[model samples]
Target: MAEVAILGGGCFWCTEAVYLEVKGVTKVESGYTGGAQPNPTYEQVCTGETGHAEVVRLEFDPAQISYRDLLVIFFTIHDPTTLNRQGNDVGTQYRSVIFYETPEQEATARQVIAEMAHVWDAPIVTELAPAAPFYKAEDYHQNYFAQHPLQGYCAFVVAPKVAKFRKTYADKLKT
Candidate 1:
């Protein structure tokens, strides 16, 4: 069965690009969640008024890759210690967060957070919240990094993260 995991680790493009290459991840969709505005637009979220974070919802085969493993990859790729920012991306929309769907997922998230605490010098500030309504981002946002690998932001920001994932989790990548 395919299990769901919603994660906001900076920009969805960065997170989505990395997970797309994971062997067990069946699907990755860039979207927005944890906000009040229904079906928020990228422009709206970028303004940071919607309270939504750019997130990627992943469907993965747990038998192939455990949930804990996914969280570990997530924590490694992004700066979880910084509040409401990632690199040059600022505001609440760029915050690092995990919207867990079940009690098991919640527990795993908390456990992962604690373990990640030892890896970083500063305290991890990633939000572990209950899964909220997820609004799919615009069609253009889906598979953005793959489609725009040469684009400025994708080249400078997203590509480096993907490269890091490729190097660190080379065995976990799809054939």
Candidate 2:
């Protein structure tokens, strides 16, 4: 059976690019969640007034890759210790968060955070909350990295994260 995991590690472009390469990840959509707005535009979310975090909603086969594995990859690819920021991107919309879809998912998120804490020098500031209504990002943001690899942000920011993911999870890459 397939399961969904809504995670926000930073810019959805970077996270989406990383998950798209994972073996069991069947689909990855860049979107907005943990917000108050009904349907927010990129500009609104950017203003940080929408209270949304740019997130990636992943559809994956759990039998092939456990949620724990996904969480591990997520934690590795971004800095969870920093609040409302990821490298050059800084704002509430870029906050680190995990919006769990179920109680089991919530438990796993907590466990993963606890285990991953030892690896980070600072306390993990990643928020764990019940999954909220996901507002799919506009067409342009869907596959930003793949569609615009040569774009400055994609080339400089997203590419490095994807490279690290490939190097660290070589065996898990889709063949």
Candidate 3:
């Protein structure tokens, strides 16, 4: 069976690119979540007024890659210590968060955060929240990193994260 995990680690472009290479992640949909708006456009979210975080909703085979493993990669790929921001992107929409679909996933997320605390000098600020309405991003946003690898933002920001994931989790990457 496939399990769902919605995570916000800075930009959905980076998160989507990383998970798309993971061995067990079957689908990664870049979207907006944890927001009040029924359908938020990227522009609205970018303005930081939608209460939504740019998130990637992933479907993965637990047997191949546990939710805990996903959390580990997520925390490493992005800085969770910075609240409402990641690097140059400063906004609530870029906050580090995990919207778990199941109790097990929630527990695992917390456990992973706890276990990873010592690795960073700052306290982890990643939010643990129940899954909310996920508004899929515009068609152009889907597979954005793959589709726009040479684009300035993708090359300067997304590419480095993808490279880190590949170097750090080579065994878990797709063949």
Per residue, candidate 1 scores C-alpha lDDT tens digits across 3-40 of 99999999999999999999899999999999999989
- Model 3: residues >4 Å from true position, as ranges? none
Strongest candidate by lDDT: 2
Clash count list over all predictions = 0, 0, 0
What's the C-alpha lDDT at position 117 in model 2?
A: 99
lDDT of each: 0.96, 0.97, 0.96
Tens digit per residue, CA lDDT, model 3, 1-175 = 9989999999999999999999999999999999898899999999999999999999999999999899999988999999999999999999999998989888898899999899999999999999999999999999999899999999999999999999999999999
Residue 134: error of model 2 in Å?
0.3
Error of 3 at 131 (Å): 0.4
The C-alpha TM-scores of every prediction are: 0.99, 0.99, 0.99
Tens digits of lDDT, candidate 2, 70-172: 9999999999999999998999999999999999999999999999999999999999999999999999998889889999999999999999999999999
The TM-score of candidate 3 is 0.99
